[model samples]
Target: MNSPYSQKIVQPDISLTICGYSKVLEIVSNKWTGLVIYAMEDGIIRYGDMRRRIEGISKKMLTQTLRQLERDGLVNRKITPAVPPIVEYSLSGLGESLLVPMKALNQWTKENYSQVELARENYDRINSGE
Candidate 1:
């Protein structure tokens, strides 16, 4: 019962391509990465405001994530000369392209989270001999 998607995945080149592309997955694999991306979805936002929007993330973590995103060309950072030297962040064109798929994943998570939780619980129970 191999569908087109599965069949394509079976191809050697396609499998290698996916392996190569997994780096992109690692870039966004952290919990904070997606939240940071979503926080900037509307438009440019100040660093302080972004920090506030993404609760529980430490300043160090935010700074690290933003730096990584900028380095990857997925986010743009701007600095304004001021008393405090204001810093702003926004999604780059690449980041904007990533948002469409991210939003789809978010929606999928919202829709299927219960099923995921159930599966996790079942797995844990079975593994624990409960």
Candidate 2:
């Protein structure tokens, strides 16, 4: 029996052949992207501050993620004219717009995570053959 969920997975129309939504997800749905966005939610943050705030992120990965976000126009990188050159990052208007939905999703996950954990526990017990 085909479920409604399965039926809903139709291909995009010709006009949407490029799958713009998918492209956006490709940019934002990575493991570190959301965390980086959340870290900048307060305001502009320096590179060192962001790296310290987001635990478990390597210097290389954070650098790569920041570059990708800047390339996608979701983040703004500013370089100060000081001797050592201070670099800071902040969300662009587009990034702020994207945050609304991402915040909603974050709230939903917090609310439902316990239920999801319980479901996983039940599934594991059922399949344990014990």
Candidate 3:
């Protein structure tokens, strides 16, 4: 029996179990993906600039995140020939669509940031018996 997700008219080219949670995980499970998206939302579109914007993220992590975003068609990578070399990363048309949702999420974070900080402090205090 074909699953509901299976194509009806045009048969799917690939067969796999892609649950909703799994799909969401694939998009935002990475620690750096949200940060990368937020950074891009600010109009900075260069590799070095991104590196600086997202502090503490190693080159390898950023490279991996960029590759994933590119593969997912959420980002565009442009290579420019110069005295040395220049590479840039920017959001694609589809990716810009994500800005609204991301911005909303950011707003929620800002609203709850203080509560989260207090909770962390309380947890630490209780655990430390202080």
Candidate 4:
């Protein structure tokens, strides 16, 4: 009954343990989080700029996601004293490290998305006939 895909999701030792895996997934599982992280990758990003860059994100959701990322130490929030009290965001050291893997995953997704969609279509067609 053993299958490669059924293997343990998290290793007991090294890299991502069960708890670590859960946390990582919890953060990256949300589409908004990944988009937010990607938005901050180049350099410090302003809240308004982020909204413009990430199309379809609501103001509330972006705010919520940023707060979560700041709480997780994955992003740094900077507030500058100004007329409106300018707010900006940037990736923390921890967040910067995550990009190495995230970028690789992005590349993989870009390369295989078509294949994945085809698989899904085939699977749906076969199952629907049953």
lDDT of 1 by residue, 1-130 (tens): 8576664454355453467568778888988999999999999999999999998999999999999999999999999999999999999999999999889999999999999999999999889964
Query: Residue-pair clashes per candidate, as listed?
Result: 0, 0, 0, 0
Residue-by-residue lDDT tens digits, candidate 2, 1-130: 9776666557646343487877767878799999999999988999999999999999999999999999999999999999889999999999899899899888999999999999999999999996
CA lDDT of every candidate: 0.92, 0.91, 0.83, 0.92
lDDT per residue as tens, model 4, 1-130: 8896687767444444457867678878888999999999999999999999999999999999999999999999999999999999999999999998899999999999999999999999999977
Evaluated against the true structure, the overall lDDT of model 2 is: 0.91
Candidate No. with top TM-score: 4
Q: Tell me the lDDT of candidate 1.
A: 0.92
Candidate 3 C-alpha lDDT tens digits along 17-92: 5566567557877989988977787553889889999989999999999999989998989889996678888888
For candidate 3, which ten residues in a row score worst on lDDT? 12-21
In model 4, the runs with Cα more than 4 Å from the true position are: 1-19
Model 1 ranges off by over 4 Å: 1-21
- For each candidate, give its TM-score against the true structure: 0.83, 0.82, 0.70, 0.84
Question: What's model 4's TM-score?
Answer: 0.84
Which segments of candidate 2 are over 4 A away from where they belong? 1-21
Q: Which regions of candidate 3 deviate over 4 angstroms?
A: 1-22, 117-130
